[model samples]
Target: MEQAEIGLIGLGVMGSNLALNIAEKGNKIAVFNRTQEATKKFYAEAGALQSQIIPCETLEEFVAAIRPPRPIIIMIKAGDPVDQQMELLKPYLSAGDIMIDAGNANFRDTMRRFDSLKDSPLTFIGMGVSGGEEGARHGPSIMVGGTEESWKRVEKVLTSISAKFNGDPCVAWLGNDGAGHFVKTIHNGIEYADMQMIAEIYGILRDGLKLSAPEISKVFGNWNTGRLNSYLIEITEKVLAAADPITGQPMVDVILDAAGQKGTGKWSVIEAQNLGVAATGIEAAVAGRILSSQKAERVEAEKILGLPDTLAFPAVDGVAFLKDLESALLAAKIGAYAQGFAVMAAASKEYGWHLPMPTIAKIWRAGCIIRSQFLDEITSAFTKDPDVANLIVTPAFAALVKETDGALRRVVSTAALAGLPVPALASALSYFDSYRRSRGTANLIQAQRDFFGAHGFDRVDGVDKHHGPWGSGAAIY
Candidate 1:
C-alpha cells in the first residue's frame, strides 16, 4: 500500500493520459472521476503502468491517498465545473496543499478563482497544457501560473513530463494568477489565423488553380521540408493525401466544409477588443469560422446572387504561383504572430502578469500546434529586444517583409480578382499597411466624427482639440 505521490481528478482523455504520463515518469499517481466506471476502465487498460495507479473511488479516499502538502491536478471542464470540483474537494484538503487547473479556461476566471482561494491555505493555480491527445500521452508544452512557492513544489515533476525544444523543457512558471492562460489564449488565436491562412491557400490550390487533392498534398509535403515545417502542416499533408476508401475520393472533399471551434478563437478576438489592440487577423479568422458555419444560407445565397462558377479559374504559371503562394503564407503568418503577441503584451500590462514574451516563443517552438521553425527566429528577435512593440519592426522580420511583401500583395489582389475569399490573409496585409504608414486617412474619419457626433478632432500641431464648423458650429451635446 504505497501512497500516491499526486492526485489526479477527472479521468477524461487529457486527464487519463496525463496520469499515465506521470506514472510513466516513475511517479505513483492517484486517480478519480465523477463516476466509478471511468476510473475502473482506466486501471483495467493501464497495461504495465497499472501498478503505479492508485484507484480512489471517493474524494476523501483520493485526498487521503496523496502524500502531505498534496498536489492535485484537475482536468475537468473549465468555468462552473471547476468551481463545483473545488467546492467538493474543499472539505478534504488541508491548508498547504495546492490545486492546479490544467484547462483552456478564460484567464479572467482563473484570476477570480485564484483570488477567492486566498482566504484558505489551498493555493489555486492556472496552467495551460497544449498538444492534442497524442502529445498529452507523450509530452506537451506546459505553462503554469501560480505563486513562487507553489511552483517550487511541483516544478521538477512538470518539467520532466513536458516536451523539450532543443533539449530545453517546454514548461515555465509565468507570472502569478492568469498569465499562463492569457498566453495560451493568444497562442490559440495565432493558431486560428495560421489555420485560416492554410485553408485559404488550400482553397486557392483546389478551386482557383484546379489542382487535385493529391497534387496539393505534394505541395504541402514540399513546404514541410522548408521554413513552413510545422505540426499543422504535417497533419494537413496527411489529411489531404488520404483517400476515402468507400467513395474513392479525396477524404477532405467528403467531409463537411463547416469548421467548428471550442470558443478559444472567439475569446481571443473578444480579449483583443477589450485591450484595444489590433488583432484583425484573428478577428477575420473567427469571422471566417462563423461564416463557414452558415452552409445552408451560403448555398441558397449563391443560387440567388449568381456568383461565378469556380470552373473559370485562371491558367497561371505553376512554378511562379507556388513561389508567390509560399511568400504570401509566410507574410500572413508574420502578421498574425505580430498581432497575437501585441494582444499578449496588452493583456500582460493590464493584468500585471509581467509575462515573458521571449520565453513564450521558446516554449512554443515545439509541442504546441503552432510550433514552427518561425518561432526560432521569433525567440531570437524577442531575446534581443524583450520590450519590442511589434515583431514586424524587428530587423529579422523587417528583412523578411522586404523579401515577401510583393508576393503577399500579389496573392491578395489575385485572390480578389479571382473572386476567391482570403479574409485572414487580406486582414494581415491591411494591418501591416496601416502599421507602416506614417499618416493615415483617419483624420477624415475624425472630421466626420467631429461633424456628426461632435467628437473633437486634434489639429496638425497634435495639440488643441477643436469642434468643426458644421451648420451652426454648435459644440452642444
Candidate 2:
C-alpha cells in the first residue's frame, strides 16, 4: 500500500475528527491511539473514508506508515501529557520529522518545547486549532508556529483542511516558536469577554426588564441579523429558544448560572499583565467566571446582605432603550476586541513574532467561536494599516466608536443605577475612557507614589524636577 502522507497520534474527539477531515480532503492519514481498540474502532467507523485511513496498532507501525520526513500531529492533552507523548514518539521519528502539538498549551511551554528540540534532528510545531469538534470534522481556523522550512512541508494539507472565509483558507504560519498558541490564547480571552458581555445584556433583559426566554431569544435573533452577527450571538439565540425535554423549560433557564473555564482565559490575563497592557474587559470576564464558581458563597452572601435597594429597573421608552442596548453591545464589543488585538500587538513585539494582524483578523472571520462579520471589518482596518498600534484608532473603528459611545455611556449609567452586574461592559467603557484621553488621573497617582515611596515623576513642563518635596504631609515645594 502507498505510504500515508501524514500521521496522527491521538483518537480523542478532536484527533479523530481531524483525521477524518484530512481523509475527506483527499490526504491519506495514518492514525494511532494509545489503545489498539480505539484505532480499530475509529477505522471501522470510518466506513467509506476507511480506505484513506491507516490504523496502526503500534508506534513503530504508525511511524513506518507515514512518508519519510514525516509530519505527525499529536492531538493529546496539553502540558505534561504532550511532553510524555513527544518523548514516546521521538524514538520512532527520524531526522526532519515534525511533531505538531495541536492543543491549548501555554505558549511559554510551547516555546520551551521548540527550543528543547532545536539541536535535535526532529522539529516542533505549536499549532492552535479552534472551532471545537464540529469544526475539526469540517474545517477550523489553524494557527501554525514553526520554522519556515518546516511550515512549507505541511502548509498544503493544513490549508486544505482549514475553514474558508470568502474562498480564502483560515490558516496561516504565524511565526516561529509560540506565536500560534499566543494568538489562540488571545482569541479565547476575547471570547470570554464577548460571551460575558452578551450574558450581561441577557441579564438586563431577563432580570431588569423581566423578559421571558422566548422574548430574549427574539432579541438575540434580531441582533444576529445586525451588527452583532456572530457565532456566539447566533448560538445565544438558539440556546434561549431551546426547551429542555425533561422540564419543558427554556434550556438556558434550567442550566446552572456558574460558568466553567479551562486555563486559556486566565493565561490571557496573566500575559496581558506581564506585557503591561490593560485588558480590563478580559480581566473582568475571567473574574466573572471565578466569582460565578463560588455559587454557594454567593447564595449565602446574598441571603445576608440582601439585594440592593435600587434593584428595580427604571421605566423608560422601551423601544428607544432597546436600541440603546444594541448600540451599547456594539461599543463594548469594540473595546474587548481592541484590547485583545493590543495584547497580540505587544506579544508580537516582545516575542519578535511580527504576527500578521490582518491575517489573524481574517482567519477569525469564520470557523472559530468568535467568528463574526465584525472581524471582517477588523480585517479591513488592519489591512489598511498593519501596525496601527491599536484597533480602536483605525479610521473605521474610530468612526464606529464615535457613533456608538453615547449609547454605551447611557446603558452603563442605567445598569449602575439599577444595581445590575455589567462588569465586562462597564470595564469596556472605562477602558475606552482611559485610553482616549491625552491627560489622565495618573499624575495624582504619581504624586501619591512619590509621597509614599519616594518614586520620581516626570514633569509635563519638561523641567528638571523629578521629585515632589513632601514634609509634614504637605508639598514642601
Candidate 3:
C-alpha cells in the first residue's frame, strides 16, 4: 500500500508542532527548514514521539521524497517569505499538486496569489490556523480558502488535524480567495476585545475594592461555573492566581500594564470603520493599549498632579459586589460578541462571501483561542434567525441584557466613584445603550440634517416640507 506523503516548510513553533500532529496521525511527513540544525531538532523531538517523519537536507530532496498528488503545507512568515517559498517550490511541484499557506498573510495577498496560480494545474489554499502553539500540537481550528476540488482532495487530513467544536471538525472551506484570513482577522479582533474586557474587570476588582489578585481570581473561578464561563476568563483567573516562582507574590503584579498588539486588532477596527459598524469594544481596547504605552506622560502626571489613592468599598456586602461584577462582565462580553458578529455580517455582505454566521459561531465553540460558552448562545441566535442583524438584539439575549444592564451601570458608577479604570467594559455597555436607543435619536438627527443639508424635514404625522433659510416652511410642489 502506498503511503500518503505531506511536506512542511519552515519548522518554527507552529509549523514544527503541526508537523508532529500530522505525523502522529500515521501519515508520512517530509520536514524542511532553512537551518539544518532546526530541522534536525524537529526530527529528534518528533522521532521521540514515535512519529513517521523524514527530515530532508534540501527542498529538492523533500519534493523528490513526497508521493504523487502531493500536499505541501507552507508555514513560513506571511509576506515576502511566502512568495519566495512558493517560487522555490513551483519548479519542483507537478501538475495536480497542492500548496497550503497556513500563515497569517493579508487577504489581499492571498487573493493575488490565487489569481496568479489560477492558470496552473497546481492548487493553492490560503488557510487560517488558530489556537496557538498548544493547539498546533493538539488540534487547532482551521479555515481554508480555495476551490472545492482542492478542498475535497485534502479534506480528510484537515478534519483529522482540526479540533472538534460541538461534535464537528473545526476545519471548513471558508469560500474562495481571502475568506480564511478575513475570518481569522476578525477572530483576533474578537480576542482583543475579550481580553481587554477581562483586564477591565481585574482593574475594577483591584482598584474599586482594593482586593488582591488571588481574591479577584477566586471570584472569576466561581463565575466560571455559570453562563459567564469562557476561555479568556478561565485563563485570566489562572493569570491572577499564579504566584511568582521566586517572590511568591501573584505573577500578574510583576507583569507590565502595557500590552503588545499584532496588526489584526487594528485591521478589524479599520475594517469596522469602513463598513460603518460599531466596534466600540475592540476600538477601546486598542486605544487602552496605546494609552498604557504612554508611561512617561503617566509618570509626569503622578509626580506633578497626584493621582487618587485606591478606594475601598464597604466590606459589609462582598457577595453583592461579586454579583454586580459578574453581571457587568456578562453584559460587556455580550456587547463585544455583538460587535464582532456585526462586523462579520457587514464583511460578508461587502465581500460577497455569504458566510454562515451560525456556523462561524459553532466552529468557535472549541479549540480556538477564543472558545467560549458564549459562542453557543451566538450560534443559537443565528440559527433562530439567519438575518438577525445583531446578537444583542436577539430576543433571549435582549432579555439577558435587560436583566443585567442595571447591574452593569451600577458597577461602572461604583468604579468611577472609586477612580478605577474600567474602560473596555464601560465602553461595551455604552455601545449597548447606544445601539438599543438608536431609534430615539432619529428626530434629533433629522433636525441636524435639515440645518445642514437643507434636505427638508417630515413631521410626526408624516407631512414633508422644505424649511427656507428664514425658517419659513414651503410645501413641495
| Candidate closest to the true structure, highest lDDT | 2
- Compose the digit string of candidate 3's lDDT tens values, residues 262-330: 688888899899999989998988888888888888889889978666465545377887898899889
The RMSD of every model to the true structure, in order and in angstroms, is 1.4, 1.6, 3.4
lDDT of residue 455 for candidate 2: 79
Which number leads on TM-score? Answer: 2
Least lDDT summed over 10 consecutive residues: which range in candidate 2? Answer: 468-477
lDDT of 1 by residue, 249-312 (tens): 9999999999999989999999999999999999999999999999999999988987765446
Candidate 3, position 77, lDDT: 86
Structural similarity to truth (TM-score) of each candidate: 0.97, 0.98, 0.91
Better-scoring candidate (lDDT), 2 or 3: 2
- In order, candidate lDDTs are 0.90, 0.94, 0.83
Which of candidates 1 and 3 reaches a greater TM-score?
1
